[model samples]
Target: MAVSRRKFISGSGLVAASVAAFPHIARPADAAATRSGQKPSKIIHLVADGMSLATLSMADQLAHLSRKRGLAWLNLHRRAGAHHGLMDMRSLSSLVTDSSAASSSWGSGSRIVNGTVNILPDGRELTTLYELFGQAGWKRGLVTTTEITHATPAGFATKGLKREAAESIATQYLDRGVEVLLGGGRKFFDKTKRKDKRDVYTEYRVKDYALLNESADLAAAPLDKRWLGTFAASHLPFTVDHTHDTKLAKSIPTLAAMTQRALEKLARHERFILQVEGGRVDHGCHMNDAAAAFFDQIAFDEALEVCLEFQRQHADTLLVITTDHSTGNPGLNGTGLRYGLSPLLFSNLLEVKASFSEILKKLSPPEERDKKPEPVTDPAKIAAIIKEAIGYEITPRRAKLLVPFIKKEGEPIYNLMNTLTCQLGQLMANYTGVGWTSGAHTSDYVPISAIGPGAERFAGFIQNTDVFRHYTNLAGIDFRNPESPLVGAVSPDSGILSPHWMA
Candidate 1:
């Protein structure tokens, strides 16, 4: 009963399959038109923050090369009957959006300026998606690889004047009744780390939340109690660094684990809405750290597989996968060697034992007061560090550049380490035919893929705000009210609907 790999691949319809299986897009049971009165009981929306189209393409290609299968999201369209489309992601103030504005578009169904969460330009606070869902008797939760209060997750439930006010965002989560909150940002919750001296963990514990920190606690927490877990002080360690560290591997939970726990807790309710974000994909692209971005992308896709399994059991659940905006514009460009590219070169990323930040810390010892530290004059030492950390041999020219730079007293090592990391990323990409534009968000449409009930509504070119409309519609929330101040007029030219729009 041994099944050959070819037969398995062919049976799955993975290879040689176009994304849209248009003929099978509709299922009679999932058709909204045929439904009597039952609504989708759950909506599991996932965001691969800052994942541009090129990022998706590169990740999909890498998965195919390494495992003979593409990303779960892409394969959903190819193998499963899912709807795929392109979505325009823009903030009110600019074509390019920060996470706050991008997420707020879907959260508030309103385009707010970049940096502000669920707050309109005229100082009005629009209702958030989670709040609306919560009011409609739906349990709500958020899971991410970034700080729980980071812009994307915070947008779903809280209104903040600025994204930097993560401390305030943390407090608002308790106020908004988000039953399951999982991610990092222990600094915002721990008494010693909080600027306000508030012991937010104690506050949540007092509020009957089963507060958990370590991975074991998260795994063992009772399913009946509300759960709040923070596995790291800041954003969870980058997947690339955390996976290789034995201690962190034991303590830290992967994005998929947090997502699974979130689903377990929130799914107990008759109706629920959950957002699971691969928030580090944005951070990796911001640093132009291709290895970090690519690996995190893989982790994010793995989280989607978890959702897919959940959806298989709960057919009433509507699942949506998308990115807030494209970042880094990563591309597969030729590497100077005529027609020579190797996907195997990317394997070196696994050899990167430490992040540049970790390496820089090792290079600079604690400073002695009033004493100037000696410059690192050894090129071999520099080369050795590179070899150990990233498995890349430093060229003579690169070594010459590193040996002269010393950590002077009062000097910051961020610039030196950041530059070196970017250089390493560029070299890795060049060897593997990968390149990136400047480390900034781009004005490009990211792909959107969906399955389960009401998923067909997401097909074709759509505005970012349309997502909010569709989600609310599917969830049976009466978002359109003419009397409500949040509703406004839509601009005919730009096609941007005012937050006050009523259907």
Candidate 2:
């Protein structure tokens, strides 16, 4: 099942040098363990996308502050048989990895460019984990809070030359042999919206895949057929907003519910690989929305609880939880008033009724330039709206700071929203001690934790690509073998399958 591409890695000078200097953290001993002929029946790889140590800690703190308990992931270390480690999530092209390259590292066992998924800079296409597992008789599936064709999930299933070519990626999954695919991006598959105007939902239905558009459909889908669920036109609603809105709560399934359904469907197979992603954690971080990010983290942890329950019943299952990279670099800074941070500061997140984006969409001035701008909304009303959306009280001074942007006739709505969100974030930081470095991913190391057989191989410091090495070895799949024959795999250089392999 090894990728047969000519593996010339595409990365920046720093990444190349680092690769040359410190090659292997530790070659997984699971290769020898595989020779013992005991492979897990299933491998559940769950990613809380764009989570850092600080993000993890904040999620734990938020959960504790609201409920009287710690998250399942937070308490994983206390379990008798568990392995935890930090993973270097750098990409081939940059120290700070994007979702595409971060996932490419794990999907292909090779570093790729920052924005490419499994496609090398030299234009080589590597075989993905989904193809490998599928060819080797394991059912493959994916679930995410992001689009199904998003880089993180798509990295495992298909070879996309560009991450934004989501329509093509959606088409790729139509016959990729994936048994279960669920997430957002209904636009990518809708015929009218697709650039090519192909009805992808119909294509999937023709292939006998059960198409699900709502929470009830996902819950009621039979396990006998493959499942395809797209719950949103874009990325799924942020957990915080969804939790508070009754209509969205009814229409969109929780990450845990999707994970549960995926597990139930895939459990019927003798062997399976299902990757569940808390993908919106990254989006929330990118937008600097703490309430959204923290709630999504908790939701992902709830998904982990489902995985842990499955593992308890099925001993031959490996459950690995990690993040692609850290986003925003959010951490708790010391508050001058308190000797130590207080959980009460984070409890305000519970009162947030909507996402900052939602609030902005509803309250911002219209984008049309031709129409004469209407009178600006009153400052007091604006302040009340912000407080209702984020639980951040806008003092008169803070209201003064936002007045110009709100009243400006020609300013883009997003600019005003960004300012408001940032101001609110700062206010939260003052009280809660939570602060963020930037709106982008950072070079900080991401954490990895695993339980069940071969979990020991994941312990200690490891490169992100080591995840591919370890998983394949644990599954007895020789990802290093260059001579293996692959079906439906296109050559990186030629962009065509070999004639002999086709036969």
Top candidate on TM-score is 2
- C-alpha lDDT of candidate 2 relative to the true structure: 0.75
- State the lDDT of candidate 2 residue by residue for 1-503, as single tens digits: 01100110010122223223322223342222232235577899999998888888888887766554678886889886788999998776567778887887888888776666687656668888888888889998899999899989988877846777799889888768689999999999899988889888899999999999999999799889999899999999988778677788789988888887788788777788899999999877776688788878988887887777677656678889999988877877665467454555655666666776676664565667678445336667777877777767777665666555445432333442344455545555765567776666788888899887778888999998888888888788987512112123234564321111000
Q: How accurate is candidate 1 locally (lDDT)?
A: 0.73
- Off-target runs (Cα >4 Å) in candidate 1 are 1-38, 65-68, 336-338, 363-379, 400-420, 480-503
Query: Cα lDDT of all candidates, in order?
Result: 0.73, 0.75
Quote each prediction's TM-score.
0.82, 0.83
RMSD of 2: 12.6
